[model samples]
Target: MHDAASALNPQALAEAAGAAMYARDTASQSLGMKLIEIRPGYARMTMPVRADMLNGHLTCHGGFIFALADSAFAFACNSHNLNTVGAGCTIDYLAPGRQDDLLTAEAVEQALAGKTGIYDVTVKNQDGRLIATFRGKSHRVSGEVAPVQR
Candidate 1:
């Protein structure tokens, strides 16, 4: 079993893990976030700025932006099929996301060691304007996101 799992294609494993996680992620689905791409230690997601997501200033709420980035971070960290959770995270909003804008969050793994990993995410609009930058620290737990296929 170990040999078979180890022999599995890395890209295939990442895709499978992402699909399995997305299927059970109600928050992402309900918020209109779409998993755009996935690979080993990388993930990209997109969410549209809807009217309901605006804050008092009529800009997209920071929580919503954070959630998008966090989802991307979650997907990237768990790409190896291990169940990983965020240990800590920080985000800086660079610009306001206007309604009707299509926002995209791209997360890249900066480092991975033992049971912990670091990821950086950049949130951008359809026109490629920067919206936010997020960094997340992840801690792996005991569990496979998807059962290994022989």
Candidate 2:
């Protein structure tokens, strides 16, 4: 995996943060995280709902679900860095997810400006049921590009 810390500067921090923040486990990463697919201007991520990821209802917590979507958003927007951070996000819960279930969130770039971008994120259960939908706004801060950044 490309190490953002090693390769990216401010200009590419958005894309590099994913790999830079990657760890072996969720606890270690502090985010529901996995980079399953990376396409131009898009990303797909998978996060396993561990028991600790549940809420009072014994279902996967919205925070955890958001993490899955957020991580995918981070990856999709930051695929090449350019310094990205979510300015806002809206998520609609379509279905609750279960512990031990693996969920995937896919993010697609919807629009962009020199300083702002929008993305559509969808979280789905292992059976292909739509679990949640999210819209994210990101700010692409200006920064000098790193040489050959990931």
Q: For candidate 1, what is the lDDT? A: 0.95
Candidate 2, lDDT over the whole model: 0.77
lDDT of 2 at 69: 90
Query: In terms of TM-score, how similar is model 1 to the real structure?
Result: 0.95
Candidate 2, residues 48-67, lDDT tens digits: the string is 88999899999999988988
Encode model 1's per-residue lDDT on 1-150: one tens digit a residue.
Answer: 234755388887798899999999999999999999999999999999999999999999999999999999999999999899999999999999999999999999999999999999999999999999999999999998988757
Clashing pairs in 1: none
Q: Which residue runs does candidate 2 get wrong by more than 4 Å?
A: 1-18, 21-32, 144-150
C-alpha lDDT score of every prediction, in listed order: 0.95, 0.77
Cα error, candidate 1, residue 135 (Å): 0.3
